[model samples]
Target chain A: MNVVVLNEVRKGFYLDSVALMRLSREVAGSPGVIEAALMMGTPSNAAIMRNAGLLEEGTAVKGNDLVIAVKAESESAAREALDNAIKSLDKPKTQGEAQAAWRPHSIAAAVTARPEINLALISVPGEFAAAEARKALNRGLHVLMFSDNVSLEDELSLKQQARAAGLLMMGPDCGTAVIGGAPLAFANKLTRGRIGIIGASGTGTQEISCLISEAGAGISHAIGVGGRDLKKDIGGITTLMAIDAFDADPETDHVVLISKPPHPDVAKSVLERIGRSRKSYTVCFIGASEVQLPANARFSPTLKGAAELALGHKQIGADFDANAVASRLPRSGRGGIEGLFAGGTLCAEAQVILAAAGRKVASNAAIPGVPKLGVEPSAGRDRLIDLGDDEYTRGRPHPMIDPSVRDDALRAALKNRDLSVILLDLVLGYGAHADPAEHLAKIAADRGQDAPVLVASVVGTEQDPQGRSAQIRKLEQAGFIVAPSNAQACELAVAIVQNAGR
Target chain B: MTDQDRPQYQQLLARKVEVVNVGLEGFVKDLRDCDIGVVHVDWKPSAGGDPQMAALLAKLGV
Candidate 1:
């Protein structure tokens, strides 16, 4: 039944007028909400209603300053929703509450009477994510956090509280997660498959998710154990809990672990835990290449490597073929990779790969090598640009998702006559909405025969998919060479560039 | 990248260049004083708005 609860509406707080309009539009668009009104001010205040677009052509009220409305659903459901929304409202704070901008999307689970929801995937910004997480945990929900930039101390406290309550708390800077066959913010919706994911890196999760989807397998659940979750103080608490959850889940078959290299002690603890479980696991702790894992745990250098291992079939009679990876190798390119990525750790992994390949960086510390292995600042030099550094990426989408920087990066590559090869990475799957190759293909077309060899690696799956292969095929059709893996793409790009020079 | 250096970021602030902060009449006077190309601020929501204040900054051409 549709019932409106008017328990807690305070006046004078801004409802993000633009966001409110969008919410009203979504409501109006929905067949469920028969009618909606935006309530404002008390009876003693200035105006009964100021600028509510949700109001009918001529609806007016005299007594209570309530945003009265009817529902498209049975009155009981609508009324209950209104009641819940009102109850959630706090006295309009002087500066506005954190959740003010986001309209609460009522998932069917919110109304269900189940005491045990498998997961709560959250993506609100870092400032308020802890509170949201605490609220979810208090309600006995296991969390898949996607917020970044949260303080480490807060994450620790939240994890401790959640542990006390026997609930799982996933991320402070968590980026990617999948629950109940749905992709959360920054997730790849792939074709359904049996592989499961447990990651501490959002981008790492994104990379592996895309890779598996591309390999024709899909994730059952991709849990994010936020970056700091594996540290000594935090102690990999959430990762352990997620492992247990996936181990018990009937849907999950294989498990993939993706994260930045952890401390030795923490790594030891994680490896030990994995050894106890029967589920086969693929681990990609980027940069800690030489760590010895037990026989059951396979190690990969990159996120894609972990995914490739997870999606490949087990053979009846085969020597563990280390070099027989079925997926495309990173395209080889000429010139050292001018890595312009957002995350420090991803940049670190790229640099590690470049170093292992004997490539010299030409620029900055982050892109470090003898020849700099990165972009350097020069007076009046405009063409060879450097992004992915902290200076350029603030307040905007990361370099992977934002096409403007990618376009600019490509333009810089094109302008540099010395640049015989363009090395780029394509991150797909959830969290990002733009088609990755949409712009690169244009740049490739513009070059025609002269186009610098454009090589990239896409990370995602069909179940939580980002359509990277289609993007690669499009680039290939446009005459640009495409590689299957980041390593292969880098190798091919370097070769092409070297050949061009010769 | 420290907060202390924020005050030194005049170029960035200039690039962010809002017309209302520059003042409508004074800006127009300065433009006319210089005899440069004129610039107008149409502060209507349908055109370009800063709705919270409901103050429309307009530049009328003859």
Candidate 2:
């Protein structure tokens, strides 16, 4: 077999990471291509290309330059793949071409064109995100920053400026929000109602909002505070602001706060502020032990519990019968649970549930009270993996955006006879993968009969671009027991594991 | 002054959301699909993504 490596660097050319990733995926799927990557020549990206063996030593590439690298079975294949990548990047879609003539080149230009624009969604590369966000804030627009890898100092500074100006700075790495019935990046289309969500975790916000919407209740707004807002440095600036916004908005009669365990001092101050609010609050700090809550607030240990308390009852019903489903499975002696999740918060929620059940849960993105999945394996220990964690998504798109990231892991877990059950989550929204369930269903269909029982849940609405019911139907048809919600998915997986060998 | 009058963010909840999408065109398409008002910004790294150059340009008020 002939092997060849080739690359082309286009000076002063640029595309956003998502477009580049899409282009790279297209090129990689070309005949005989082993691997392909289209990235800007930033130091970090260049390093990624180098580590992937796509770049030669001492290759001259600058940050503004576009790098297209392909390794293929032959020189002809490599050349063809690179040409196709370049062509794909150059070819403009019909709508984009029509709008290209009038699209603004900067935030200032955009604001000038639409002066009524009160919100700026910043999704540039992390190095350049803060600058764009600063410009947006200066223009008196609230910001939803969808880019990650931004420095801590920049986030702190940006949030402070937005606070002083009384504007909302949603994130430097914020991924989800639904403001005034408008679904922002990576959010479900939810009905407008009384519950307002202030979440530090992206998927936590989505799960709560989707559950609320599914319960016939609705969301006034689901504001993302990034992942680190409740840390000691940021001190819940956006969270506090979102709480205030909900408190003042007459449309919102209740508020739900969701996050991993926050910095103790920040949590205290945040709770104190929620205490002053006239509206009732449900605080779901996953994995956080019981603390003194404000009189107006109730504490929930899971995302479903948060929605339940906010709705004033248990409105979300069970999607499947766990005991009956477990009884149908083979009673294997092997008993280990493996959870592969696209949502980090879903993974954390699973870990919290498993930990509370006296099971030692290890994860790459472990919340408080759970141990990290170390390099050395612990025998018989349950593992929940957040494929959306930075380690899994360094150069590739997020698992929610590109479901292929979870494929190899899911396959391995399914084939592992040591596992009694495999837990999974399919997140659906505007920015998520078009049909993640189809991708997983195809893989699950290939698993042997003796393979572990597959239990899963979906965090989305029926109104999402990828319909939730359709995704669940696909999974269920492919031999998966689909739970209604993420928390129930974990419980169902536990039931299956415990029922094994009984 | 009441708490409602203290923050400008609260006022945002009462108004319609008109968005200026910077960096990603996909987000623009998503917002438009939902019948929300949005404009796209064809964003590129200023000063060719060089940190020093970008900082210099910022200092020069570019």
Candidate 3:
């Protein structure tokens, strides 16, 4: 009989034991059976063994506790294993359960059996992700985690485990990435080149990964450290590890770090860590630029600039001047600036910039929710809100994910008599659900002749060259002025309002 | 063995109902009831036919 071991398949959350035991007994007493043992640690695993009838007769082990063995030859045995495992099992556990597992093949085995598989991506749910991750690490495979909603506790623990094992865990909710010049889920494959990326934003990572590749640089890996890894308690655990890995990799030369604003303390720690590294670094923390850069680190006003600066270094007509972009920006009239963003970090950084300029912005607003836009006499406040915020978005794609939200807001902003200026973040890359250009075109088409909509975008070429170019072309064709950095967009928006008031 | 004369022969005949059967370790007793045929199918949506069903159908040459 040929024996096959199915690896990494796991019981979802809320596993049951009774049904499995009955199934186990059926398998054990089957004709032509040689021997089989159901191997598992969870309680429900035992039930499967008992039903297969491998349990010693008169043994005290209950169905859930029974561990049984059975033997059969060929594909029959393998099928029996799968059948006996899921018998009488009811509904799936919470979506958080790990419903999948992976089999580890040795390096030589992998090379021989799956030579074409240059990448290994993982998408098991959060609960059992760590164990499967461990198996991937043991096999020396690069892992891309698509599961989100993981606890910070599990994230830190798993990251530490991954680091020790010497593997990459791309995300807890890593929505997009490109590897070895190949498109993975939500990735746009482009020409490969120099800048390798480590980003907190999955879309941001996809954009930068594609940009670097488009700029004639190949990515060694685009590691996504999930949004929460840079928080105070987590302290950039995965980000730092990914950075070091990128630094050592011969395939990567430039590294870009993108995230929404983290806690001040965590930001400082991240800056310190980046400062210690010898590699050239470009950073775009969405809200505040709290941490001063080390000699090798450079800060950008937007993720777009960071990608360009990291990949092309100094390109002509590409404004690398930070203050220039800031100066070019239109100020929020003495009123408040209304900044509606889909990405969290973009909001965080915008608030920091506003506060530093002696302006106050509401973070998570509660009541009387007319979002502030222009400057006011009391204080120059900036309102940073997510179009994808729970109050506004759910079940629906976040504004950044889809452009229809932008058009709706554009119409609303144009109609508001009290509104000074409108601000938006347009993200483009692989895995992004909508095109920024088409969205901008809709905004341009919908705008009242008198209202000027200020547009800012974090877009680039590597992930989806055709899509990126198409979005840019569409926006340009619409006569809507586009800015590269979020700060620049804010400044431009404010300038338009301030100039109008004068 | 004629159906009339074979209770002992039926026991011997029943054992021949299956070909090779393999499962996890220790659950051999489940096979005691060889009266019914057991088939296994993968959980994937693409898996349409059970191994036993297919094998049985093939024997019928349908």
Candidate that would win on DockQ: 2
Tens-place lDDT digits, model 2, residues A273-295 = 99999999999999788778989
Minimum summed lDDT over a 10-residue window in model 1 chain A is located at A314-323
For candidate 2 chain A, the 10 contiguous residues with the lowest summed lDDT are: A369-378
True contacts kept of 1: 0.00
- Residues B9-49, model 1: lDDT tens digits: 11111121111100111222222232322222211121111
Docking quality category of candidate 3 according to DockQ thresholds: incorrect
Q: What ranking of all candidate models by lDDT puts the best one first?
A: 2, 1, 3
Interface RMSD of each: 23.0, 1.7, 24.0
TM-score, per-candidate, Cα-based: 0.60, 0.96, 0.56
Instruction: Tell me the tens digit of each residue's lDDT in model 1 across A1-502.
Output: 5433222233233332223333334444544565554433222111323332333345443222234342445556555545545543433555563432322222122414333233455543233445545555555555556545556876887788777776667687666666544454466666566788888877767666665665556777777788787778888988887776666666777899877777778889988988887788998887566877877789987655676688774221133221332122332323333544534445555655655655554434342232333345432211212354434543234555455556766776655555555666666654453576676677656663443455555554433234655766766776555556555655554455445445
Per-candidate chain B TM? 0.29, 0.68, 0.23
Q: Candidate 1: deviation at residue A31, Å?
A: 40
Candidate scoring better on lDDT of 2 and 3: 2
Best by lDDT: 2
